[model samples]
Target: MTEMNYRTALVTGASSGLGRGLALWFGKKGVKVYAAARRRPQLEALAREARASGANIEPVELDVSEAETTLERIRELDDACGGLDLVVANAGVGGMTDGRNFPWEHAKKVIDVNVTGAVATLSAVLPRMVERNRGHLVGVSSLASCRGLPQNAAYSASKAFLNTFLESLRVDLHGTQVRVTCIKPGFVKTEMTANIQHMMPFLLEAEPAVEFMARAIVRGEDEYGFPWPMDRAVGLAKFVPNVLFDAVASKVVL
Candidate 1:
């Protein structure tokens, strides 16, 4: 774990859900936070709230799915902050349909926003961090990344990519001051999961979940999986036979 105060942090998808929570928390910690999301009104409201708390929070309009726009915005944010100390690629979408039944456009959209966006964000900052030899990168994965699940194949696979990518990044940055952490949370009560119709195990509210994630980032953990029960569940799932896993997962609602 690295022990240095971060003066600036950038969080994507910060208009709502876990991103918003992280932005608020970081701002409260007196870190200059650049909060980005596509929706202007929502982001503006978030900025207002953060300002009310006497924290430096800059709201930026960004759609992670748009690579050029996102990259440009990253450059702008970097210039504004002089240098970024923390980067949290937290923008993602959940697809409700099975892979076969899923619309191809939806799959593309999910991957574009979740996997490619994360890579782009990392690419924008990694070089600078390497040169400075200091910073932390946090990618928000999910428990679904640990194994294939039913109904949400796109979402699950996207997270799996993040898990592997972040792990590889951590390895690449080994011995350097740069730290990469993959946060795999179980079912969290956020707008994204509000319409989900399945039984969610070890469900946690957004605030607590964000707090846990922030602590993990600050500690420079290699990986952070939440809710002891779900962590064990995922661990066991990894050992289960594929046939059995498929059979069991078939019954789970997305």
Candidate 2:
């Protein structure tokens, strides 16, 4: 295993949630961080907080949904840093639609950010990483990818896409120094999950979740899902026969 002591990193969707947490985590370790988000104020606020930790943070106002502009900004930021050691495609949205209603727009938006956006982020940085054979790509996918939920179909499917994509990317980059990691976290307390409007089993605060994620990245784990109890529960659910699963999972209060 190659040792990873990243000096610089780029984290997308850093305005809030896991993205912000991870950016700050890296900052604390003395890694220069380029944080990107759609909202300028939030990015500025994050940079301020990071600076307070004595971490260098460059705030880049970016919307991951805009693939072209997102790529352009990534290029500019990478150039400014001279290169990138890690890129976490963490920007995402949730569409809480149920089986009763098929909201095409919501599903499409989920796919745009969670799926297309992740690939675009990879596209923007992959060339340079390949050339150098040294970089880490992490997709902040959800443990929700393990099982599809009734009201969270779109969000579930989108994350599932990310999980699969990252896994395949890892295979493609097997012999290279460019490593790909998929982090499948369970319910986490963040602005993104604030609107979940239901119970999240084993919900964890961002700080601890960031700790787990940071460890995973440093260890170069191909797949990381936490907290462990939730990961096991979700992974076990995969083996439940559809009939029993439908009866049990469908009755889930959330």
lDDT of 1 by residue, 1-254 (tens): 43238999999989899999999998998899999888889999999998899988898888998897788889788877888999999988986657667688888899999999988887787888899998888999998888777777788899999999998989898999988989998989999999877788789999899889888988888998998799888988899998888888887655
TM for every model, in the order presented, reads: 0.96, 0.95
Model 2 TM-score on a 0 to 1 scale: 0.95
**C-alpha lDDT of residue 197 in model 2:** 76
Could you tell me how far off, in angstroms, the CA of residue 86 lies in candidate 2 after the best superposition?
A: 0.4
Least accurate 10 contiguous residues by lDDT in model 2: 1-10
Taking the tens digit of each residue's C-alpha lDDT, what string does model 2 give over 123-205? 79788999988899999998889888878898998899898888888999999999999999898998888877777889999
Which model scores highest in TM-score?
1
Off by over 4 Å in 1: 1-4
lDDT of 2 at 187: 87
